[model samples]
Target: MPEDLTRTARAEGQPLSETDNVEDMYLTFALGGEDYGVGIGGVTEIVGMQRIMGVPDVPAWIKGVINLRGKVIPLVDVRLRFGMAERAYDDRTVIIVLEVAAAPVGLIVDGVSEVLDIPPAQIDRPGQFGRSRSPVMGLARVGDRVTILLDAEVLVADGDLALPAELEA
Candidate 1:
């Protein structure tokens, strides 16, 4: 998330698009050298480092759930989700609470960078924005990092989205 993103809708995100929207904000985080982003719309909160209980029989990417107040939200390691090497948690670790298709999930990130507002002009087609694994609609340059503006619905809940088998309905 950049310093400019709003907790609710922005004036720009209101407009419709033929495919991807022009007005959107992305919350940026780090996973090793690659910096990734999620839609600011889906973000509920950016919390400080917390304890995440480990559960057996879950995918490596699924770091398990946490007690967020009274709500139990599943935690996903963004690095592992991207098929990257796993690392120990530290002070910089953050849980980005997000809503995807109405389901709340917490993404474990290296750190919460900032909230950014990216106008449609900065965005490119999905192919140009991302690679084969994730389809992104836009890009935002934050400092030395280039964060991919994610389409939350697709990014968070893929058909073969590496979800824990038990989560299947």
Candidate 2:
């Protein structure tokens, strides 16, 4: 458990100290065959795929809710969130639990890669897309691979939260 926590912390890019040049660490994952990453600090845990109860009146991307240790956490499919076609959840599917705005939410990703330490020198600002909002934090180059880093806070905006009112209570 401690190791898992350590990995999670590293993935979230928790600053080591005041003098550490490593800007942040990211928890990389896959979605629609493309690599993406999120700050490790945002991730609470990574759990195997489970039953997700559907909710009405919410965006299609917002899959539904899951009973995680008696807490009802809303689930959002990363692929659908990015307008990618829905694919069957296989053995690799995992739900990444995150605390966004103090609320626990689940993000379904194709699979988790590994935690990477990305410094500022390796990150580049995202290019502007006309009339569209982006959830990207920055583009990180790790070795020969590029990972699209995401901002959890921006990804789950207050307006995007459509969990049933009862669950919010």
Candidate 3:
């Protein structure tokens, strides 16, 4: 399923604009038993977990980097980033590569569910929770399932780590 999404994303190879058909589409994945979604526009591809080379002097949540083809992408452990307990990576673990702020990043998730077309009407905007900024863009309600829609740019940029300038192209 991840491969299929990767192929579809690669075949398109273009970030979805507001006028595009995929504007409301989201690629949903699991993290710590909760469902999370990211706008499909920023997604480049999804790949199975592979070797991650350790890097020095970086945050623990930034779990080093991986070399896919010839591109070096920094891997972020979503669980650790969200202050959840770290779990061992299994076969279901995969990387969701995204283009945030013109830099490539890979998020390690438990597994992907599927691509869903959630219309604006079905989404509820998150209220200000006193935080300066939030990674959550909205809450998507589809039937009985509720997915936390994340702002990929904010999710990637939310910490002290300056990713764009540090990440290798």
In candidate 3, which residue ranges exceed 4 Å CA deviation? 1-20, 160-169
Return the candidate ranking by lDDT, descending. 3, 2, 1
Count of clashing residue pairs in every prediction: 7, 5, 0
Instruction: List residue ranges in candidate 1 displaced over 4 A.
Output: 1-23, 128-135, 141-145, 158-169
Clashing pairs in 3: none
List of clashing residue pairs for candidate 2: 11-40, 12-39, 12-40, 12-41, 13-25
The reply for model 2, stretches above 4 Å from the true place, is 1-23
- For model 2, residues 118-146, the per-residue Cα lDDT tens digits are 77778998875452657887888766777
How well does each candidate superpose onto the true structure, as a TM-score?
Answer: 0.71, 0.83, 0.83
Candidate 3, residues 15-125: lDDT per residue as tens digits? 433453577788999998899999888899989999998877888899988889888888889999898999999999999999988878999999998776677888999
> Candidate 2, residue 31: CA error in Å?
1.1
What global local distance difference test value does model 1 have?
0.66
Candidate 1: give its CA RMSD in angstroms.
Answer: 6.4
**Which candidate leads in lDDT?**
3
Higher-TM-score candidate of 1 and 3: 3
Provide the RMSD of all predictions against the true structure, rounded to 1 decimal.
6.4, 4.3, 5.8
Q: Residue by residue across 110-160, what tens digits does model 1's lDDT show?
A: 887655555555555555534555546566554455667666665555432
